[model samples]
Target: MSTAKPSQFGVAGLGVMGVNLALNIADHGFSVAGWEFSPKRLAAVQAEKPYERLKTTGSLEEFVGMLERPRRILLMVTAGDPVDQMMDRLAPLLSPGDVLIDGGNSWFQDTQRREKAYREKGLRFIGMGVSGGEEGARHGPSLMPGGPAEAYEHIRPVVEAIAAKTDQGACVTHVGPGGAGHFVKMVHNGIEYADMQLLAETYDVLRRGLGLSPDALVNTLAEWNEGISGSFLLETTLQVLRKKDPETGKPLVDLVLDKAGQKGTGKWTVQVSLDLGVPVPSIASALDARNLSAMKDERVAASAKLPAPQAALTDEEKQHLAAWTHDALYAARVVTYAQGMRLIQAASKEYQWNVSLAELARIWRGGCIIRAKLLTPLREAFTQQPDLPNLVVSEAFAPVLTRMAPAWRRVVGTATRLGIPVPVFSSSLAYLDSYRSAELPQNLTQAQRDAFGAHTYQRRDRPEAGFVHSDWS
Candidate 1:
């Protein structure tokens, strides 16, 4: 019952990402109808000649008229509530077979709800995860689409052509049904937060603790970027520190706004981890760091921030702090990335989506928001063992961590003695220890679950259980 035609698509919202994506689609020879609420924005887009054959429509009806039934509309609007607003405005004007694609960092739950509602109208909806940032939007991105299998077919060619590719081919694929695409994107953001916090903490230790200059810190970071810890986030942090303010000749980062703004996916990642019964302390710490960053001004004014007393650092102490922080950062990064991949795996399993974890990793190897060369090994690791707990736990990663563990411990102990906050790093080390723990009290959890929900329990001695518990005195 679909009515989509080839070479017809529409990009709604003329934000930077949307405009670039529109240009990308148009460059692929697809006729696109670009819609924007602002006349100025509409004119600006027109002025850019993003697409030579592009059409501009002020009316929703005219935009719909540009395509056949099952129209393809990509919503490049803001995440959360704005997505719902756009859908409400667009739904009534579309026909039964139309398709709505959300290219924002929307909550996966919202995507699921929207898809259900759209289904009732005999329309289709897709929750798509697109990374590679603004630059990638103009050239290529890592695209993850989740929804009807049939709907994917109509858009696959364009998605493939516009996604970052590996040695094999294009990087895009149908992620899975429901909200898997958005869910995966949330994990990506969470991992991003962890990665950023690790590098920041490293900078703090080197600067305040070791009295290294910004240039030194940048040098150290660049070195890390060359190894397993090497990734897009670390590389970018180095670049940011390299930026100097022309006005005062100070680092632009020092004067740039203190309150770091986020689009909420990182918070959602930690929240979802809690709900899913996953231990994501590293990710949680990263989330807490973001929250704390927002309160920087308030914290500074509170009794001059009541800075903690400094401790004398012995050679051993300095060495330990450096080592421990390294391990923690390295381990935490692995956990956060693994947690994201696991989330994607769970979503794919739960929704019957055939998303290729390997392919997703490959897409991340280049032009997308989270792109980094490290993804090559990650993609390869997954290909070898799809059920890996994390990249850190893999045989390939063991030697790397083993070499890095001593440094990680030193850094952690030094931070502990100095009362320096390193939540993400500490949480990552904690996660590593917990994962490698030989025994956990699962029996107690089972007992609690049975007590609350009358859930069945399995006894150690017997396959079928007479539920029992021993009270610890």
Candidate 2:
């Protein structure tokens, strides 16, 4: 009875994500011992008798003891203080070479601090980003792990065994040293926010402007999903639009509240982008859209007072509206992804992480929420030019954007005329316009700044002159 070998891996939380991940590890032929602080959760997991090789225990000491030497423990608890507290508890129990992975949405700085602290103590700490909700956790998820190279080697077998597989490879990579994994994940979520907002705007514009029923909308989106527009989120949108209320027989999404929720990652992305001087206006606009959506009562009250546009689409405009919207959606999405990737690039440069955008696109091809057909070309673009200044000018996407820009303008114009708020669409379009223009009105802004604050301005006409003050007064 006592001759059995110790579990090969350890999971120190039995939450939904933890249990599913433990089961996934066991499914990959690794014995995993799980521990949970909550007795109810522990009892619930134990009651299920999930996996024969996955053992659940309430005792923390026993859980730590069950793992083989140089233990590989994944802490899938809440982000922030809980992760630190868990680290404190596990530090005393772990050996010098034992690995502790914090698989939560923690801030990158915190991860850096923790990794530095743990390295000093001779323990390996990995800040891993796990994407693809519960189902992906049980089946396969995109795993972004950043830490010491040696520590990555320690857990590579287990991670690769359980990660989503595509033709490129497993959906897991040792992102970089320090907090690059979490940083990339944060940007991933920021892209997700922009992508979702674009979808929402598409849905709203089509539903309100074209007056299409849910069934018609589903058909339209389903056709889009078959082409280059295919993505996990769009597929999920199709599913949501197809469902009917069990009790009322009404379209389920129609009955749900208009408010949206977030878990701070999008805000963090925008915040970090500001620090890095990267413009992520698409993401920022998406975050603003969510915040505005939360003021349901204010919007409802304002609806009664504020006057909406009375302009109507012509017959030709109505006929071309859907096609225009499809192009607009795709174009805006490209811009959104461009913004997110640029932010990641800036962060990588600042942090000296050297994260490979090609590898990220490769891994995101499957399992992750933002998985899309576009990632193939995106990967190719990065592979061709690792230091590409912007995705908009890439050989793969420039012609496409040029071809689609007219339709995008039409969609934006139609939405504006109809008084529909396509925040992500308009902002992404503005970002594109600003990037392409050689001359902007910002010279006036610089002059105003100098006039007000004595800020020196660089003159374009003076070939050799440096920054100078004007006598415009």
Candidate 3:
């Protein structure tokens, strides 16, 4: 109730992400006024004193009052119903030209629908995808914002200031109109799932097949992080491996349950891929691997009935296989990212969002879960050829595939021989082979379809001619 007007930006919701992001804004010299529906969470925020500059209010009305005219408000609540509920409450209180930004993991379709609804009422709605977890929120994160172009100016400073920066620039962009931000974020999470699965498979092979202890595994992964396979996820895996259990005096990872949990972004990615007619075999396989892992009881029972794995590698052979496994992991990751980028490209065309593939790679190069050295080359590849068909065939990556093909094959073969389940690894290799093949066995499939369902088949001799239906005797 000072005579002064309020801050430049307001944040609604006081969850961990919400508070940290508010603090991040405050850290950059922007006064942040925040509102939380949960009194317990608001009290905790007050107790923690996360940032000195954040102003808090007890009600949404007062929070709305605590911002400047044409206010920029960031909504960090849970996605779905809660978001709609909050908007319904807040929209009535705001004047025209006031901007509300959703920084949640909302479905892109919801964003598209909401943007239109809000626009008709003279309110600007931005569906922004904020990546990087708690740590990134406190420091910096990659931000993808899509909305009406005019509304972006009001929030651009806050977005850029709180975003991670590399030598290239800040890890944030006005992606495109209508739900483009969320769509790209969804694809980002999909690639993350596949990348993590590949990492888990690599760890399993090195530990089980090569007899590497957790200590040895940590060193190996740490070493790999210094090479072409280096990444934030790989670096984090090394840290996880190094942690010891307090209760049992063993590695903490071994003590934890093997089941992985996801919040559905990966599933959405594969589903959307099907809708768009894009092949995302690596991503699909990764999602299936997680589902397969979740069937722990059935897997445990089946393990007893199945044949045991055989590990027959000598120390010399283990050394060679470890190197090959590294290359194999690199190859899989390349394919996974390539498939994800392709999905984004297809969506851009279908949605008319015109998102820049090069900018996406540049922003993802920092403050994201999937940040890696690989993105450097990826950014360059897209920059050189804006419409490059696939990343695997890019000049920067094709040589890598050529050089690693033999080793990648050996890793898959070694895993197969040892009975290690490598769904993603094998699937990625299969995708690569299928992509490069000029001829496939689908002709027989067409012939069979024609016989059973009268589906027409195109002859190779007259490929451009219309489809011809033939009766099978």
Candidate 4:
């Protein structure tokens, strides 16, 4: 077991994502040491499974001791408080040049704090955003690593080598300093929320309007995956839909619950967008859907208690509704990604993240849940112009929106008329239209910001950096 300076990789947490990433590292030929608090959890690693390269250490001290000098460890633990626990325990034990990588759904502010804390200990802290979910963790993850360039140098080879690769190459890249990676990841998740919302709306239309079974929907999704709409998440959604229900004769997806659950990342995405003065309406609406789903009991009661139209729907109207919904979902989904990328581009300028949007799109294409083949053109567009303001105006994507907008509009009109809550998709289209319009009703908003903060604002007449202060009292 003791080879002269064998490259050792250790994962500190044994949670689902952690376990899968550890397995991936081991599966890819790197020697791995995994540390978990519970012996019972460690027993699962010992169990006869496909990946055997992982060796569980008895204690935290022991795990830290196993790695060679300039040790590299990835903390795949839950984000927030628990991250500090690992740092506190290991900072003393780790050498000056050792690296501690955080690969979790942590806030960018937290990443900055942790990186600063670890730097004082002389142990480099890498704030990395590791995406691709469970399967990607076990196969190829799209990794965004940010920290000291030296620390990145030590770990980049391992990370890039193990990351998910396209036919062209690896999905991993150095995102930038401190919180940049996590910030980028946060935006990525926000975009994902909007994308999934669109897909769900499309599914609703297909099911309600076309009278398509889950199997039929799966077929449609699969076909879409082959075209410009193609993506890893889309491909998987088809798989999830095609699965048969265990208790019933229908598709498993049909039998499954409708409500979607969310972790904090999506919320963070919306919050960050707000803080940055960036509009992510589609993402916000998607988050709202999950929030509404969580309020099912209240919503159900409201439906029951409120005076509502308890009427039957006509078949023709239903078909029209579905057809309209599909188009709306597509347009909204595209706009959501556009907004998310724009937010990141704005941040890149502010924070000096030096992020490569092309690599980001490519990395997202495979490992992440929102991945799709449409990302290839996105990646290419970004590569050509690293600081492109928005994915909406990208030459490759513009034509798509131009062609689809009319259809998308028709769908939105039909859904609204039918009283369907196509929030994610509809909200996206709304925001898109508003964004393109030269005029926006911002007088009220500016009045409010000025009223409270007395924040300086430029006069519309002069349009200069000079402020026009208002005395509200």
lDDT of 2 by residue, 106-213 (tens): 999999999999999999999999999998899999999998889999999999999999998899999999999999999999999999999999999999999999
Q: Report the CA-based lDDT of candidate 4 relative to the real structure.
A: 0.79
Query: Which runs of model 1 end up more than 4 angstroms from their true locations?
Result: 1-7, 68-70, 301-307, 316-328, 440-466, 469-473
Q: What is the C-alpha lDDT profile of model 4 across 1-473, one tens digit per residue? A: 55635348889988788888888888778888888987887777667484556777659988887777779999988888889988998888988999999999889989988898888877899989888888888888888888888889998878977888878678887888889899998998888887877777787756654567887777767766776677666777888887886677677776666678988888998888888898888889989988888887788888767754334356655546544544555566678888988888878778887878887887776666777766788789888887777878888877778878877876665555545567876787788778778988787788778888997566778886587778777
TM-score of 3: 0.98
Question: Looking at candidate 2, what is the lDDT of residue 449?
Answer: 90
The alpha-carbon deviation from the true structure for residue 345 of candidate 3, after best TM-score superposition, in angstroms, is 0.2
What TM-score, over all chains together, does every model reach? 0.88, 0.99, 0.98, 0.90
Taking the tens digit of each residue's C-alpha lDDT, what string does model 1 give over 87-189? Answer: 9998889888888999998888889999999999888999998888887898888887888888888778778877776775787877778887888778877
Candidate 4, poorest ten consecutive residues by summed lDDT:
307-316
Least accurate 10 contiguous residues by lDDT in model 3: 308-317
Lowest lDDT sum, 10 consecutive residues, model 2, at 463-472
Sorted by TM-score (best first), the order is 2, 3, 4, 1
Q: Which candidate leads in lDDT?
A: 2
The model with the greatest TM-score is 2
Tally clashing residue pairs in candidate 3: 0
